[model samples]
Target chain A: MNNERILLVSRPKGTPAMSDFRYEEAAVPELKGDQVLVKTIYLSVDPYMRGRMNDTKSYVPPFELNEVISGGIVGQVVQSLSSDLAEGDFVIGNLPWQKYNVVNDISVRKLDSNIAPLSANLGVLGMTGLTAYFGLLDIGKPQEGETVVVSGAAGAVGTIVGQIAKIKGARVVGIAGSEEKTAYLKNELGFDEVINYKTDNVFEALKAACPGGVDVYFDNVGGEISDAVLRLLNHGARIPVCGQIALYNLEKMDVGPRIQSQLLINSALMKGFIVSDYAAHFEEGAMELAKWLMEGKLSYKENIVEGFENTIDAFLGLFKGENTGKQLVKVAEPENV
Target chain B: MNNERILLVSRPKGTPAMSDFRYEEAAVPELKGDQVLVKTIYLSVDPYMRGRMNDTKSYVPPFELNEVISGGIVGQVVQSLSSDLAEGDFVIGNLPWQKYNVVNDISVRKLDSNIAPLSANLGVLGMTGLTAYFGLLDIGKPQEGETVVVSGAAGAVGTIVGQIAKIKGARVVGIAGSEEKTAYLKNELGFDEVINYKTDNVFEALKAACPGGVDVYFDNVGGEISDAVLRLLNHGARIPVCGQIALYNLEKMDVGPRIQSQLLINSALMKGFIVSDYAAHFEEGAMELAKWLMEGKLSYKENIVEGFENTIDAFLGLFKGENTGKQLVKVAEPENV
Candidate 1:
């Protein structure tokens, strides 16, 4: 069978273009001992991937030139070897951008579709959900009656964070790019207030929304949005730096007002973290997130594009704010199911 | 008796000038019920006082115009109307910058002169020492074998912080303005390495000193100095924002490279704190610091300018880096001693 994949041909200067990626067709090889042949079902494309495209030192290494771009993928096992034999089973792993992956069994986790939808393993039941869970609860730590302001409120992690803040009995204010996103956050997710960054003066609107001042800030889109929120922080405020989607494509380093004096005057805290830092607590975090999902306390939205040929387009769309929530590409359906 | 005091004649625009203060002679008030008379002996002039001189909201309220500039003062109780104290007792209180103060019994703590020098109550064993004790141990949390860097290393709090980090078995690096101050940090305070930020290339010297990267940063002087240190932080680094003496004199807001991306990529934590935040544990902190002092494990330095006439000069000298350690003005000596 033919295994078609996408390779990163060139690094981007600012925003990535179609020419940066090359589509290639290769023959699938026979599965060796302890290896599993899986057909890709869904693939995750995130903003952090922008960092990996550049040849720089970061949390994750930059993607090598002319190499297959790899990330979180959910697939169905077509053939397996070793004692954990499975000819038809759903699994999730960090695999290459390909239609079929011949990977070691240890890299993939067998998923039960009976618990939730298969595509959810690539989103709410996956890394995105866990990111919000740990970063908000552990770092943000919104106490009851405190105000929580979340940027990128309609995206995968921000959506969950807002709902969780509401669950904790805190006043939740969300900042997003569109009126539709603001409406969904307030009307559907029970957010106390939502600010449309594109249509409204974020600083004045935010000042009006949070009258008591911000106690916890879950930052997803850093830039002027973060700079505005920081000006209104109360004493002992906590800011969890989750993502800086705004500066992902900038050719030069970001410059802004230095915050040492602000932090010192308010005695505030700002911390940064990645999801894998909480690896030991994954089981606990996943259990709580799943419980919230089952109890209707949490609702998630996924924006999926059909076909493997459009994978690169789907990935590039993230930078343009084209997707309202988690962006994924659907490669194929489980043949056995 | 005449009670001479310094009054804030005008608010400063940037750096404070001698003209902003007025030396006045006022009548001494008679001691009332429950009131004691304290004759000021040693007066503390700190970098944080610069903020109080501005007519803006801050951690402490701005000093009222034409009022006595009140701050940490050590005095000798010359007269007492309360049974809680008697004459000849040494005490510490936040009193006006005056030759004599009429205060209530609850406002002052009587000190035992035999424990240490009376002036030590204003510096090493007092607020400055407590500031270093909590800010470094609680916020910085330097573990053994880690690299700890302290800015303003010749200042009262910075000197204590470097010594405490050394006691914790961490490699300590000090950043100061002059080679003389840097030499004091390394030779007198037992710092592992010292960088003269004025003469030496601070960024390159810091990188060489901290071969393992900075794990804990005690920031007393913030600005480009902090930016340099932030670039070299290791994974999970902790930064305690204690003071921003460098920016205290700026008339306008400070602008520099944003640090959110650096903290995010390293999973670092930066916290701003005032010594009073840990007030609940002041006794515990003082005990530990005092124990270290008595055991010869800790040493302190004070730069004293004789006479109450030089009080304003001593306070203004802080911005010019005139004093090495704790800067103080000696108003009067204990007659009984």
Candidate 2:
């Protein structure tokens, strides 16, 4: 058997370029005890991956130089040596950007294809969904009739966040980069108001949109858009920061107006968190998300780029706001299916 | 009887000047139903008062122009017609900065002069103490073996915050503007580390002091100092912003390195709050604080200036970082005492 994997050849400077990644071919090794030979079906590309590419100390360690980049990947078990997993079973794990992965059966969890699509396990029913779930519900805690302003409102987490806030009876206001995103959020996702940050004066637009002031701000794309939303925060506002896509590619330290004073005066809360922080309650979150989806109360979209070769492009496109929702790369299909 | 009061004659542009305040004399009116004529003993002048001085909305409404300035005042009941208060009883209330005030009996709470000094009710046992108590325990939640860093270590809230952090068995590091403040925090308060922010390279000093990174940052002075503390935050660090004394006097918008990225990468929490946010739990906090003080686990200091004439000067000195602890003006000694 053969395997091809993308390696981080060099660290990115400013914006990541194609030259930073290198694809190499290798022979797939035979499976050992408890090991399963899995073929990649779909790979998730997220804004947070950009941070791991840099050699810096963060909640998660930086990806090593010349190492295979790993993220949320859903694969099918082609060969198994453990009772926990069986041949032809679809599983999801934090796996490398490779055509084939030889991992222990315990490393991947078997997925129920009947619950949702195989790819949805890597998205809406997966980490992205859980990120929005815990960040919004646990931290943001939007109350009934309160206003919720979400940045990256058309992205994977944002879309889910807006729906969840709506479910909680909050007036949803979304800020996105394009008119298409703004329209989708307002029309499809039931966002009460949408601001096109790229074209609109975000500060003015936000002020106009949130007449009662923002009670909860679900921040995914931090920067100027966040600054505008922060200024209009109501007293006792909650801000759950899940991502900072805007600052991820910057080569130098990013500077802007300090937020502490605004937070101080408003008696607001701003918390930053990764999805895995709530690993203890992931089952509870995933169950609720699945229930919402099954009931038609939740919807998710995926910008699926076909083939393994386009993975880098899919990942890089996240910074450019190319994807409306979860960005994924389809490498192969389930052999048994 | 004659009464002298200081009024906010004009709105201050940046730092408050003496001209912004005007002294007015009025006749002390006769006590009406349930009214008490209270003579001011000690009036607190806090940094947060600067925010109220501006004609801008905050947690508390801005001080109305041409109206008498008001804040935490510890006074003695000189003449009472109500059953709640009697002659010579010490009381505290949010009252006008006047030599004598005729207010409804329900407006003031009687203080137990036996439990602590009457002045302590306005400092370590009152709003200032409650601010530190709730801001630290509720928001910061400093754990044993964690590093707790507090700015404005010599000020009213900071002093109590350090003591509380120490009580929780956390390693306390204090940041203040002078050697005297640093020495006091380290030598008298038993702070594990103290950084003289004015003379030291705060970033480097803090880094050296907190080798394990900051776990709880009680931010009283926001600006470059906060930026530096924010950078060294450990994962899940909690910051309770009590005040922004450093930016209180700024004429223009203050800008610095945006903090969301750092907070995100660390999965940290930064919340801004005033003492009144925990109003419902005041008795619990005040009881615990009193217990700590009686057990000799807590100590406080007050920089009390003499006479009603210097009230404006005392308030102005807060912007200059002039007072080491709770800044107050002794309007008059208790009439009965």
Per-residue lDDT over A228-247 for candidate 1, one digit per residue giving the tens place of the 0 to 100 score: 99999999999999999998
lDDT of 1 by residue, B239-331 (tens): 999999989999888989899998898999999999889989999998998899999989999999999999999988998887888999999
**Candidate 2: residue B133 lDDT (0-100):** 94
Clashing pairs in 1: none
Candidate 1, DockQ score (0 to 1): 0.86
Candidate 1's C-alpha runs over 4 A off are none
Rate residue B237 of model 1 by lDDT: 97
Q: How many collisions per candidate?
A: 0, 0
lDDT per residue for candidate 2 within A136-178, as digits (tens), equals 9999999999999999999999999999999999999999999
Docking class of 2: high
- DockQ score of candidate 2? 0.88
What is the lDDT for A243 in model 1?
Answer: 96
- Cα deviation at A266, candidate 1, in Å, is 1.0
